[model samples]
Target: MCTYLHGPRQGGMYYFRRGIPAPLRSIIGKREFLISLGVKDREQAKRMIPQYTTETQAILDAAASHGPDTAPSPMRAAADFALWQNKQEAAEYQYQHSMEQEEAAIAREPLVSALEQKLKLSVDKLSPEEQAAKDIIDNLKFELKLSQEKRMPERAGGERPENSSNAKGQLKQSGAAGPVSSAQTSISAMYEGYATQPGLREATVRQFRSIINHLINFLGHDIANQVSSDDLIRWRQFLQKEAAVKGKPRSAQTINNSYLAAASVTFDYGFNERLIPKNPVALVGKVRAEKKIRLRSPDFTKAERKAILSASLSIDAGRRSAQLVGALRWVPWLCAYTGARVNEMTQLRREDITKIDDVWAVEITPVAGDVKTDEARLVPIHEHLIEQGFLEYIDACPEGPLFYDPDKSGVGLQRGQYKRVGMRLAEWVRGLGIGQVGDRSLQPNHAWRHTFKTICLEAGIEERAMDYMQGHASRGVGRTYGSNTLPMLQVQLAKFPRFELG
Candidate 1:
């Protein structure tokens, strides 16, 4: 007590003094802890001493509960929290055993006063019959008491405070319906805010949400400040090591995207909100994405294309919902000659395919829904496509989208949800063993784009013109003007070798 008092009698400051326990003195490598109270009066210092005493006792009691040795604060808090939980369970079973359902609904603090009046012991000292009050909230209350009593300083998770070796990290505010200690936004909360940005597509928003969820699951902590570069590193390793495409490790593209998503959510949002001091993932470099895709997905071969055409017309076209059959049937052919992506083919409206000038054309644009580029263009109706009854399919849907699942369609939903429409063809391809080239199978629907580029090059189509026709970003200054206009592109379509489907 005398050591805690220092300075001249005329003017002096009070300090906290606690000798390190013998067993932990060497490990702590400190003889004593001293912190200034910043006070000049003796009475205030006297009043503060009890709080420091109780906090130290709680820490030592936690150490004593586990064994006769002093341990660090996180370990001590863990042991104390465990003991508190056990005692609460015993007390609850003894006094409120019959109240389990109702008690569970009512938070523990809301019922604490009633429990205390009946049992009449401080929660820390567990009695035989009253031992059954092991609610987690009670543990939170005890932890909060220790933190407030000690006036603990800020530090990282699982880190010791500068003031005391036995001091744990700051206590978080209880999630219960009560007065919260402070305003702290969590990782999950940050994600909720990020999801609200306008102009983000449903698919793009979902990807960002998925990145945050991966990080949350990996670190097992939703608190933003607690996250560290180590956590990001482990998560990256997990995605690279555990994420797979057909039992093979994920491509560098997938891994790189995951890292990008995580950094955006954590550093971008967390830093802006001041929830974190700095972005924990800022220095975590992206995985070196492989330039060439290593996935086994391949383009449709000659024989495979022929078989698919046969199935669509013979078996599928005769089904009860012939309209759906038409979508599945012509979708591949539309992709074949036009070199358009699968979604573009499935999402086109009847109005989208109309005669422009003298040439009948397919208008690939955003009138139906969100286009990949949001930039509309015209692909002249290839003679092979029009010859395959495509005009008849458009006539069948004069007022609506040509391809859609009627079950999932609603007023708020986008045009046809062709995710399944695209998938069904991939499975059909897999069924025919068409997805494989050598030992590798083509990535379901995307292989068409690859096949289209290959065929265009083989057909001697102008190199730069292919980009514009396919909705790909154009290259070169002159290429930005595009190789030709809509009518001339019709000529290029005529050059494409036609495959008979009707």
Candidate 2:
């Protein structure tokens, strides 16, 4: 005799087995056997036992109907089993739907492999939400096999209209084309217009060209009339994304400047040439950049000044010939005392210095036709510079620039040596373990100018007088007196105390 069991725990199926075994007694406890009948109450378990036994007996009778010697038909058995399983699954899903609508909404779509690849490409340039929508569309296409089933109507003899259909398709394609680009027109005008500014350095020109190129490439050929305010905004966002992807989002000031340069030039050209009715860039406002001031004082203290001077003189003769040391020592000291720019100091010649009423002054007016800002001014040599051996150094290099580059190759000292000297000085400072402020890695030669201003302010020198000494524009009486004369300027120069390193 065989024991029989049927319950929800057996997946709502009927089963029979001889399970009485001493070793397996713990495996199926009393509670499990009762629960297997789909009944928690003792009364319900007793009542369901007969019904379960009846179902199990029916399953056994059906199995017996298929003779032991007969082979089961695989196709018929599989189809019948699938139909029953699908119906059961549908019932289960219907029962669970009330509790899982939110979860179902978030479920992933079933997209074919090929459709997935194409959808990824199409939505690559869209935002996250748009990409999700595109994914759903791709899944629908795969589920329906829409593309494969799209067929044209058959002609009576199966002949197709070739030329006419091709012509219509071409016309449809041409009608959807984008706008044309204004690259050649705008860029050519910008380059030609600003080619003559005196202050336009080589570096500035390069930056201008770079900004124009970026705009042209991003906008493409049909960019002129097709571009709108929203397009510019999108372009800016794209630039930020590109920078972030490269691990360095450009500074806000840098982005603003680039945008201004490109947009302003293009729109201005368009407006002036009557290519457009008005300037598009005129709508954009200036980007307020953070103010950067080099307040880290480089002026040497009294002791450090002496040490540097001693180091200069004590340098191995083989390292920097004695003549070079003697020539360079007074240069750094003059820089600390007068605060003259390195370029101005390096370019100074003996003839540029003159004595007025026994007071020495340095003339810095542009020689002949070589003015930097197309304006010339005289700079007075400090009395401290004279005391620090400027007079002696002047006697040494009387004809040419005081700080001459021995390497007479390339662009020469006037342009390159100034930067080299600054770098060398920074290295020397670092070697001494003294902390430098504000970009310590690259010593700023311009710090001397700041030192000069600070010292002048500290000494209680009148603002106008100090401005005149520094060769800056002055106001009021100082402006009217306009002491362009050497003697009059000499009187004003006498007021500035000679600078001392200590």
Q: List the residue pairs that clash in candidate 2.
A: 179-222, 180-221, 180-222, 180-223, 181-221, 181-222, 302-502, 384-498
The 10-residue segment of model 1 with minimum total lDDT is 96-105
- Score each candidate by Cα lDDT: 0.57, 0.45
Residue 368 Cα positional deviation in candidate 2, in Å, after optimal superposition: 10
Residue 473 displacement (Å), model 1: 0.6
Give lDDT tens digits, candidate 2, residues 334-355.
Answer: 5665555554555555687777
TM accuracy, model 1: 0.58
Model 1 CA lDDT for position 71? 35
Instruction: Give RMSD (Å) of candidate 2 vs. truth.
Output: 32.9
Report the CA-based lDDT of candidate 1 relative to the real structure.
Answer: 0.57
Model 1 over residues 270-345: C-alpha lDDT tens digits? 5444455444553344566556645543677777667766766664454436546766678877877777877787
**Native-referenced Cα lDDT, model 2:** 0.45
lDDT of 2 at 31: 11
Q: Can you give the TM-score per candidate against the true fold?
A: 0.58, 0.48
